[model samples]
Structures are given as structure tokens and as C-alpha cells.
Target: MARSGIQYADVQQAIDALLTRGDAPSVQRIREVLGTGSFTTISEHFRHWRNEREQNRDVPPPKGVPEAVATLATDMWRQAQEVANEGLVHYREEANRKVEAAQDEVLQATREAGDAAQRECALAEHLHHREERMEALGAQLADSQAQQSALLARCNNAEQDSAAWAKDVGRLKTRLEQQTSEHAQQRETERGLFGQQLGEEQQRNEATEGKLLALLDSVRQERADDDKAQRKRTQQLQARLESASEEGRESRRELKAAEETQAQWQRRYEQAENEARAQHETVLQHRREAEALHERLLRAERTLDAEREQRIQEADWQVSLSQRLDALQQQVATLPATAPENDDDKPAEDHSDSPPKT
Candidate 1:
């Protein structure tokens, strides 16, 4: 960088000022006099000024001046210029020493600045490496967090499934309990109905027996009177007696059929009782099955297809039972009422074979 604005005229003016003050003009002195100019600018201008002064110095003295006087004045002026030159030399030495010291300071400052720059560069590189490491760590942390979030979501889903499974188990258990209680009640009701029907049948059979016996005795008495009172009516009396015997035989057969029906009913009652006991055992088995179901709930999802088929089969079986019950009821409804002896013609419908569908 060079200082600007210093012209030849400015340098020349400064040099003349120095001469008027009786000081030797040098580049440093002219620069000092001007107070603001570059050494190169002042030196170039001073060179030109010295060339002009040299050319003018060889010119003759003024027209009025004598040769001897002018020569003495020139000697004296040369001697004074020599003295000023000596002082300029001393000033230049001092200026050189100060300039050297300034240069040393500039060199020292440059070295310190270079050291600071090196330290700053090293720090910037270290910071860059640190930032890269931080970025890598942050990426790893993000991956870990994503994995953890996935695991947590899976855990939450598993927890929800477990809760629903537990609720289903409790619900099934409650339903089983209710069904068991109802089955027991149904069994007892059927038992009581069967017992009542059995008693009623027995009573009806006994009453029919007594009425047949009385009719037989009355016929016997009429036959004796007919035979004893009139010989003419003997054939008719014999026919009437034969008819009474046939009626007794028919009545006896009906009584035997009634007894057979009673025995059949008794057997059915026992069978019903057995079936009820079996049903109770089935309930216990169902309890065991429920326990097994609870133990195997984890397998529930796997068995869904198979269980769907099972449920379909069970539904069909229930439908069949319903149809059978309906048919049996219609049969009973269509059966005609008969004499007390033949009252047991309608067979007691046994429905204890199959448990009721839930």
C-alpha cells in the first residue's frame, strides 16, 4: 500500500522550507517537513530537485556582483551546506535506528499473528471433528430410540391382547357357571315331573282294575239269577255269561298292557335319572374342559379355524335336537284320548338323552 496525494510541487516546497531553515534536505527530512508523504514519493521528487539545482549552480553570479566576492560567498555557502549535511547524517542515523526498532516490532507482531492463526485453524479442525462425532452419535441414538419405540408398541399390543384374553376367560367361566346351575334345575324338574306322572299312571291303573272287578261280579250275579229263575232263558243267559267272560279277559289284557306301560315308564324314569347323573358328569367334564381352555388360551388363535368347524357341528346337532323335540310334541298332540285302561297309549316322551344346547 502506497500513500497518495504527494506531488512534485509539494516535495519541492518542503525542500525549500528546509533550505531556508539552514538544514540539509533529505528524503526523510522532506517527509518529516511535509508531515504526510511516502518516502519513495519524497525521494523521487528530491532527486529531480537536486538535478535542477546542479544545473543552476554552474550559472554565473548576478551581473552586478564582482567575481572574487561571489567566489567567497559560494565557499561560505558550500561550507554551511557541509555542516547541514553532517547534521542530516546524524538525524539519518537516529531515524535508521528507530526504523530498525519498528521493523523488529512488526516482525514480532507478524510471528504472533501467524501463531494465533495456526492455533485458530487447529481449534476449527478439532471443532469440526467433534461436530462430526456428535452427528454420528445423534444418528445412533435415533436408531436406538426407534427400536425402543417399536419394542414398546409391541409390548403394548401384547398387554392389550392379554387383557382381552383374561376378560374372555372370565366371561366364559361365568357363562359355564350359569349353564351348570340351569342344567341342575332342569334335571330336578324333569325328575319331579316323571315321578308325578308315574304316580298318576299307577292310580289310574288301580281305579280301572277295581271297576273291572265290580263289573265281573255284577255279571256273575245276573247269570245265576237268569239260570235259576227260567229254564227257557238259559241259552240267552249262557251267551251273556260268555260275553261277560270275554269282557273280563279283555279287561285283564288291558290291565296287563297298563302294567307293562307302567314298567316302561319306571324304566324311563330310571334312565332319566341316569341321564341326569351323566349330565352332571358332563358338567364336571365341562369344568375340566374350561380349565383346559384357560390353560391353552395362548393356542386359541391357532385353533380358531378348527374351532369354527366344531361350532358349526354343534349348531347342527342342536338344530337336530330341536327338530326331534318338535316332532315328538306333535306326535303327543295328535294321539287320541282313550279309556282309563288304554290311557297309557301315548308314550312318555323321553328327552333326557341329549343335553340342552346352550
Candidate 2:
């Protein structure tokens, strides 16, 4: 009685046609036409229809039963009951077959549904795991970003410190250069003074040689005059000889004194020359020390410059790292919540392959 739609009417007609043919249609065919796999459902509907028809037959005719036709109605009722019983038996057999087929179909559908549900559950679990992995990667990326920021700050400070050290080194180099120049000038002055003193000593030695030569000529002239005066006065010859001998002795002593004075001057000159040489050597040693100091300062300045450049390079690297971190952060921010799928309902590993933060 609940069968009220066109689809239900069509199914009832199909059932009647199958019954009339004395061969019930296969459940597959019914399912193909009815778009349902349940044989029990089909059998139940047929049972309900047969029961409704039988109930109608069992009901008494509406106010038309007469005694004269009672015997005839009874005979017709017996034959109708026999025919109904045969039809019911045929319906029952068909219902059993349909029920078996429907049960098989339901079981198959249930298995398929179960398999599908299992697959879906597996996929959902896999997606959940992937989401957790992505979340962990994002957290790691955030931590790396934080480290990069701190490193960048430290690098910037190092660069500033290097620049200051470079400036200080530059000032120190300038002062060292000035000191070196003054030392060089002093050495030149010392050399010039030494040369002038040597020239003055040489001139004094030449004048002393000229005075000794004149004194030797005067002694020769006096000896000749003494010989002539002794020949002229025989009586006073002895006295003159005595006087001449005293004069000769005095001249020899004077000559010895002059020679000793000249030797002293020579010794003094040699000492002065040796002192000058020693002073020159000392000055040269000082100059070498100054030069060495200057070289050391230059090397130190170069080292400072190299260190400064290295710090600057490090700073640049830190800046680049910060930029990369910023870019990675931006990319993370723009990532979609739901990952896209391909044919297999699996999310691709796009974000996972991204570079490290910074």
C-alpha cells in the first residue's frame, strides 16, 4: 500500500510480468533496472503485493451474497483458492531466489564500502601526519629565522667595531710615519756634521806640517853662522862651541816637543775619527730600528685592514641571510591552509623542499 510512486508501479508491473512468465527475473537484471542491489527489498515488495491481493479476495462481496448462488459461489471460491495457492507457491520460490541474490549483492556492496572507508581513513591519517610534519617544519623555520636575526645583529655590531678599529689604526699609522720622517732627517744632519768635522781636522794637520818645515830651515841657517864665528875668534872658540852645543841641545829638545805634540794631535784625530765612526754606527742602528718599527706598523695596519674587510664581508653575509629569512617568512605566511591534491588524493611535497630559513 505504501508503493505510491511511478517507480514503485513500474517495479510492480515488472514483478507481475515475471510471475506470468513462470520464471522470475534474475536479481542482477532487477537491480540493473531498479538501480538497487537488495533482493530482499524486491521480495518484500512482491510479498506485500500478494498479501494485499489475497486480503482483497478474502473480504466478502459488498452486500451481494445470495443463497441461490451460494453453491455456485462456493465452487468458484474453491477453484480460486487452488489457483491462489499455486501462485503463492510460485511467488515464494521466486522470492527465495531474489532474496538470496539480494543478500549477495548487499554483501558485495558492504565489502566494497568497507574497503572504500578503510582507504579513506588511511588517506585521512596520512594527511594528518603530513600536516603535523609541515607544522614542525614551520616551527623549525621560525627558530632558524630567529637565530638568523640574532646573528645578523651580531655581525652588524662587529662591522661597526671593525670600522672604529680601522680608524684608530689609520691615526696610529700617520703618527708613526711622522716619527719616521723626523728620524731620517736627524740621521742626515748627523752625517753632515761628521763630514764637516773630518774636513776641519785635515786642515789643522796640514798647517802643523808647514810650521815644522820652517823650524827645520831656521836651525840649518843658525849652525852655519856658528861655524863661521868660531873660525874668526880662536881664543873665544871654546866659549862659542859651548854656547853652540847648548843651543843645539835646546833646538833638539824643542824638536822632540813639537814631534810629541804632533803625535798627540794624530792620536786625538784617530780617537775623534773612531768616535765619529762609532756614533755613525749607532745612528745607523737607530735608523734600522726605526725602519723596522715602521715596517711593523705597516704590517699591523695591513692586518687591521684585512680584519676590517673580513668583518665587513661577514656583515654582508649576515644581511643576505636576514633577507633570505624574511623572504622565507613571507612565503610561509602566504602558504595555503589546505594543500592541493593530484590524482591520488595525496598532497605534494612542495613546501617541504623549501630552503632553510635565512
Candidate 3:
């Protein structure tokens, strides 16, 4: 009669198949081969099968069997047992390797999960830092904008002041030109007066010479009678010539002084014009500098805006990474906490004792 367990035949057949194919078999392997038995049931069935084979071998030969035949039969059974034992050892080693590999895989998975968590934390920290940087950049940009506004206002004021200064310069030039014209007219008037005075003096000198010539003729005609009168007239004519020469020299000196005064006025006018030009040039230089500063500010603002946009993009990417990390964390949380049912019913793997012999 068969031992307990309806799967005994199935287990025996699975073992037989493994032996035919030169494969080591175990309770776990038998379950794998059958695809539908628990380890406890399969191990029980395998033990029963081993017992039946051993019992059949131990049955004494009937009707005086030959000693050589019995010895040969025993030898064959021993060799079979040895082969089965060797196969079992190889199967146990293979099972141990598989278990270790499974443990290693579990460890690897745990490490990967840990690494993922660490990465998520790092990403969160980095995101926070990015947000802070973005805030700082925003503040900086606001400050820059305020500064730009102030600078623009200052530039506008400078431009207005420059315009006012230029207008003042133009007004001054106009006034100076008017003064110069008036001064020139006055100088012409003085020159005309001096010329008239000189002409009158020349006319008086010519009249005196004519009168002296007439007196000389009279003295010559009178001879000794008018000698005293002629001498007195000659002395008066000599004094008159001396006085006219002195007046002409004084007029020449006055004209020379007037020319010098005109020259001084011209130099002053030229100096004022040069000073005005220098002021205008200075204003132009200031305007150029302001323009350059404004241009640089514009470029910096553009750069800041671009960086702000890039930071925004990075912030969005970080958020996506955070979402992925959340999903991963959830998956890790859902992992199984227990081993498989087959592992629970697994047969003893460390025993080296062979099956009981007949």
C-alpha cells in the first residue's frame, strides 16, 4: 500500500525525470517541476518514495538466489545511491547560490531606494537654494531697475542743465557780439574826431605859412625902416610852427592808445569765446559718459532677465524631479514585507547526511 500523500506518484515521477535528465532533485525542485505542490507535501512524498525503493532493495531473495547475483544487485543499488547523493549536493549548492543571489538583489534594491531618497533630498535642498537665489536675483533686479530709473532721471536733469548752460552761453555770445559792434562803432567815431582835429591843425599851419611869407615880403620892401617889426614877426612864426608840431604829435599818441585799447578788447572777446567752447565740450563729454552708462545698464538688465528666465526653468525641472521622487517613494513603500510561501516550506539545505540505506 502507498504511504500517505496522494502526490507521492507525482513526486516520484518528477524525481525520476530529474534523474533521467542528469539533474539533481530536491523537495523545492520537485515542487518547481510539478508547478503545483507545497514543499512540506513534496518533501513527505519524496521521503516515502525513498523509503519504498529502500524497502524493495532490502527484501531477501526467494528460492536461494545466487550469491554473485545478490552481490551485483547490492553493488548496483549502492552506485545509484551514490549518484543520487552527488546530485542532491549539487542541487543544494545551486539552491544556496540562488538564495544568495536573491538576497543580493534585495540589498541592491534597498540601496537603490536609499540612493533615490538621498537624491530626492538633495534635489529638494537644491531647489530651495535655487528659490532663494531667485529671490535674491529678484531683489537685485529691482534694485538695478530703481538705480536705472534714478540714473535716467539724473541724466535727464543733466541734459536739461546742459541745454540751459548752452542757452546761457548763446545769450552771452549774442550780448558780447552786440557789445563788440557798439565798441567798434565808438572807436570809429573817435578815429573820425581825431582825423578832423588833425585836418584843422594842418589848415591853420598852412595859413600861418602864407601870412609869414607875406610879412617877409613887406620887411624886405621896408628894409631898415621895418627891421624890428620883421624880427618880431619871424619869432612869432617860429613859435607857431613849434606849437603845431606838438599838437600833431599828441594826436598821434592818442590814436596809438585807442588802438591798444581796441586790441585789448579783441583779446578779451576771444578769451570768452574759448571759455564758452570749453564748457560746451565738457557738457558733451558728460553726455557721452551718461549714454555709455545707460547702455551698460541695459545690457546688464537683459542679462539679469535671461538668468531669471533660466532659473525659472530650472525651478520647474526641480519640481518635476520632486514629483518623480514622490512616485518612487510611494513605490518603495508598497514593496512586499514577507518571503514567498514556497520559501516558508523550503527543505533543510545544510544537511550532508545521505538517505537511509537498505
Deviation in Å, model 1, residue 112 alpha carbon: 2.3
Return the lDDT, model 1, position 345.
16
lDDT of each model, Cα atoms only? 0.55, 0.50, 0.60
Q: Estimate, for each residue in 7-56, the C-alpha lDDT of model 1 and write its tens digit.
A: 88898788667655555566667778889877666666666665665556
Candidate order, TM-score descending: 3, 1, 2
- TM-score of candidate 3 versus the correct structure, residues matched by position: 0.40
For each of the candidates, give the backbone clash count: 0, 1, 0
Off by over 4 Å in 2: 1-79, 93-102, 200-358
Off by over 4 Å in 3: 1-233, 337-358
Question: Which pairs clash in the backbone of model 2?
Answer: 39-102
Q: Candidate 3's error at 313, in angstroms?
A: 0.8
Rank candidates by lDDT, best first. Answer: 3, 1, 2
For candidate 3, write residues 285-344 as lDDT tens digits.
Answer: 655665665576567557656766766776676566666656555544443221223322
Q: Give the range where candidate 1 is weakest over 10 consecutive residues by summed lDDT.
A: 338-347
Model 1 quality (TM-score)? 0.38
